[model samples]
Target: MRFATVLAVPATILGAASAATTVPVTYEPKYDNGNFSLLGTACSDGQNGLVTKHYDTAGSLPSFPNVGGAFTVSGWNSSDCGSCYQLTWQNNSIYITAIDVTQQGFNIALAAMNNLTGNLAVQLGRVSASYDPADGSKCGF
Candidate 1:
């Protein structure tokens, strides 16, 4: 009976580990200059439309011209906050965090995309960011 209980525990743990879903991600180079100018100010989140308002995270301001493969995902959800993703694009693989969301849920910033792929004009084929449930890294979350 003791052996059977231990075996069941491992199986249950494995089952839960396998439940993490792989989300497909695609992004285009689009600059959100509106949000760029408001950093470090009271209205940085979107006062008078001075910037493109991002989903507020506690007290952090959205980094504009987003760098370092910083990405935006679907919406503010408890399950999504503090999640990490393994993004891959032709000969390159980087681990980036999911921040905000837009009509196109998963997107890489213009500057960050440019850094990832040398030529912004080059179309990335089958780009994807795989979510890893165990990661505890937080960006805007």
Candidate 2:
């Protein structure tokens, strides 16, 4: 019985460790040209092209531009770029590609913010959300 109890403890700990991580989410208005170039996007050059082709099939601007990869600014790297996550806020969820890194949480695109907030982006500039890894095959994973 003692061995079984010990096994349960490690299983519980592992479950907690693997749980989805939640983070703050904010919005950024689109650039004048309706692109994310001015923000010094890290993945805009090549990875973004692949991201767009995979996710932006509706002919709309890509969503979820900024992400706190590894949950820190300095922690972000090329490997984190172009990663995809499913962000959940309230009862809404949206898939976002990690085009840039941010220390202020996941800085989403304005269009995505609107969609997630039911067109309340103007009223709610920031919110708490959780993210989980999505299928990255389309993102060249």
Best by TM-score: 2
Q: How accurate is candidate 2 locally (lDDT)?
A: 0.57
Clashing residue pairs in candidate 1 (N, C-alpha, C atoms within 3 angstroms): 34-51
Q: Candidate 2, clashing residue pairs? A: none
Error of 1 at 45 (Å): 11
Among all windows of ten consecutive residues in candidate 1, which has the lowest summed lDDT? 41-50
lDDT of each: 0.40, 0.57
Q: Model 1 RMSD to the real structure?
A: 8.2
Residue 5 error, candidate 2, Å: 14
Model 1, span 13-132: residue lDDT tens = 778845644444455443333343323322223322112345332123333333222233233342343245554445554454444444432465555455545544247532444444
Off by over 4 Å in 1: 1-74, 102-105, 121-141
